[model samples]
Target: MRVLELLEEIEEIVDTAAGFPLTGKIMVDSQELLEIVREIRAELPDEIQQAQWIKNERERIIAEARTQYEAVIEDAQKQADALVENNDITVKAKLRADELMRVTENTAKQLKIGTYDYLDSILYSFQGKMEHLSSIYFGEMFTSIEKAFDDINSALAANRDELKDMAYRTQMDADDIPAPSAESEEEDQ
Candidate 1:
């Protein structure tokens, strides 16, 4: 489902929730919200994949650039070899070949730099959205932790090991976040 649909689902839940007497809080249906959150998680990977495809395309373009560069070099060699019998013709052929090689190399470099810049911009845009998502996701996790703290003192005394296990699992889940690159680490700071 689209993101707007997910937002709409959340809105619907909030709108239909049972209100508290004095607190400005509503009792939400956990199972329904969990299902929608899962759906949102499922959709998130698709967006990530779309961004990943730009990286893939950049590699492809680099490959094609290399191929064209090689082809140019081969053609230049063949032309120079065919005119080897005449010194002047051979000289001209070699000069033309060198010029073509230089031009192709410069073109390839520009293409690669441009591709990298384009991919970087795209990833940065996605990063902002992903950060927002992480904030929301962990915000929910923090709320759960707060609630668990509220009533779990006696229960925790009884099942301390179970609480430890739950905290461990939550930590593991949170640690599943992708690590940033050196540049992104700087950006984050």
Candidate 2:
């Protein structure tokens, strides 16, 4: 979230920058840009940590569900064993134990299903946020930065070419100036 806000600030800076007349180039504060970029780098670890937390929480929930399932199964088995030990109502006890087992199994299945659905929803939401951030914010920011660098490189190359041309002309002009003869040098002496 802080990263998103920082990205928006960068966008605002670019949008508000003053452009060179007819050049399609804008001047930005390099210091501000660098500072915001540093902040973004700093915030990235926090985002990663949040993702790690989500994964840990999901695992914890799953473990809890498994523990509950085991506890329910154990309880159902103990009850069935106790019922079977009674020799007077063996038939009724066996039937009751079978019904209890079916109900317990169904409840365990539902609990597992519910746990999976909850984890899936959480993961789905996280995935959406990641997609939105990458596609909308990072994508546009990278494009703009790339274009700016390309413009800067073009301008620098043109300036270097102009300097080379000026240097060549200066050399040609020096060559054109005639050197004084020996007689002219003697007269000056």
Candidate 3:
């Protein structure tokens, strides 16, 4: 976000800079442009770190879900075993244990699905911002800056593709549960 703000400042400078008569060229302060570019470079790492944090948070949530699932399965098994020892209600105990396992599995799946959706939404927003920057600033006078934006855009596209692949793999593993639709995401927004 800070990078975007700095970009807006750069845009303002360009917009306000004086232009030559009969040419499409404009004058801008090189030092001012360099300072803002430095600021943007500094802010870029923070954005990347935030993306990394999202990924770590997703892993943590999945781990927590697995732990809870295991705990519940263990508890259900213990209860079923105790009931089996008393031969009178073995059938009922088996049925209850199965039900518990099914419910626990469904809960775990939902948790994982929710985590993936949350991460997808965040990456989607970030991808949009990167695209916006690439469209607005590319092909300007700053060749080095254009290359930097190009690299950032490429990285973002790769990240987005990776996320999509992850979600697809997860969906296939989860019995083909449908992924959230873009329309639904837009509605939520």
Estimate candidate 2's RMSD in Å. Answer: 2.1
Could you tell me the lDDT of residue 1 within candidate 1?
35
Q: TM-scores of the models, in the given order?
A: 0.64, 0.87, 0.63
> In angstroms, how far off is 146's CA in candidate 1?
6.7
Candidate 3 colliding pairs: none
Candidate 3 residue lDDT tens string, 13-110: 77787765564445566788888888878888896888799789888888888898899899999999989976668889999999999998998899
| Candidate 3 structure lDDT | 0.79
Superposed on all Cα atoms, the candidates' RMSDs to the truth, in angstroms, are 22.9, 2.1, 30.2
Which window of ten consecutive residues has the lowest lDDT sum in model 1? 145-154
- Model 1 misplacement above 4 A: 129-189
Please give the ranking of all candidate structures by TM-score, highest first, separated by commas: 2, 1, 3
Which candidate, 1 or 2, would have the higher lDDT against the true structure? 2
lDDT per residue for candidate 2 within 97-116, as digits (tens), equals 77877877787788778878
Q: Taking the tens digit of each residue's C-alpha lDDT, what string does model 1 give over 21-87?
A: 6644466666777787787777777877887797798788778878877887788788778988899
